[model samples]
Target: MFLGKVVGSVWATQKEVGMEHLKLLLVQPIHADGTDAGTQVICADRIGAGQGETVIVSRGSSARILISKDSPVDAVVVGIVDSFEYCKE
Candidate 1:
């Protein structure tokens, strides 16, 4: 799992049958301190995460399981973050 912000959205009129019902989002990975960590990733959203909202992303097999084991998703927005606090050392 990782922290990220929804940067954009994806629209696909033609997609696999298993993917048709999912909302795809472009997410920018963020560090615990709220800094950009890496390149953006496309994630399937089932929790209604909107653009600019902070979300929790799950990758790999776990992500695929969110929808189903047969789902074609490699990343998924598992949760919408309400708040975050980082403790500096």
Candidate 2:
């Protein structure tokens, strides 16, 4: 899992099998200190996360747990962050 901020959204007119209902989002990888960690990633969301929200992302097989164990999703939003604390000093 990783911390990320939703940067934008993605619209795909043509859907792959089992991917029709998933909402895709563009997320900028972030560290606990609210700084960029890596390149942005496109994630699949089912819990209604919008732009600028901080979300917890699950990757690989863990991402498929909520939908299906065989889902082809590479990333999924697991939690919508309400509040968090971080310090790097």
Candidate 3:
């Protein structure tokens, strides 16, 4: 799993059969301290996460399994993050 923020959305007029109904979002991964970690990623939204909301993401086969065993999704927004605790050193 990874922590990220929903930065944007993706609109696809046409897509694979199983992917058509999924809401795609652009997420910017962030560290627990809330700093940008790297480049943004496109994720399938399952929790109705909106832009600017913190979210939890799952990648690879784990993400695919949420939709179906044969789902082609590589990443998914599995949960909307309510809060987090990060220990500072």
Model 3 deviation from the true structure expressed as Cα RMSD, one decimal place? 0.8
Residue 62 C-alpha lDDT in model 3 = 92
What is the C-alpha lDDT profile of model 1 across 1-89, one tens digit per residue?
99999999999999886998988999999999889999999999988999899999999999998788998899999999999889999
In model 1, which regions exceed 4 Å deviation?
none
Off by over 4 Å in 2: none
Candidate 3, residues 12-86, lDDT tens digits: the string is 998887898999999999999999999899999967899899999999999998988787899999999898889
lDDT of 2 by residue, 1-89 (tens): 99999999999998777889999999999999898999999999999999999999999888877777777889999899999988667
Q: What is the lDDT of candidate 1?
A: 0.94
**Count of clashes, each model:** 0, 0, 0
The 10-residue segment of model 2 with minimum total lDDT is: 63-72
Q: Which stretches in model 3 have alpha-carbon errors above 4 Å? A: none
Per-residue lDDT of 13 in model 1: 94
| TM-score-best of 1 and 3 | 1
- CA RMSD per model (angstroms): 0.7, 1.0, 0.8
Q: Rate the local accuracy (lDDT) of all candidates.
A: 0.94, 0.92, 0.93
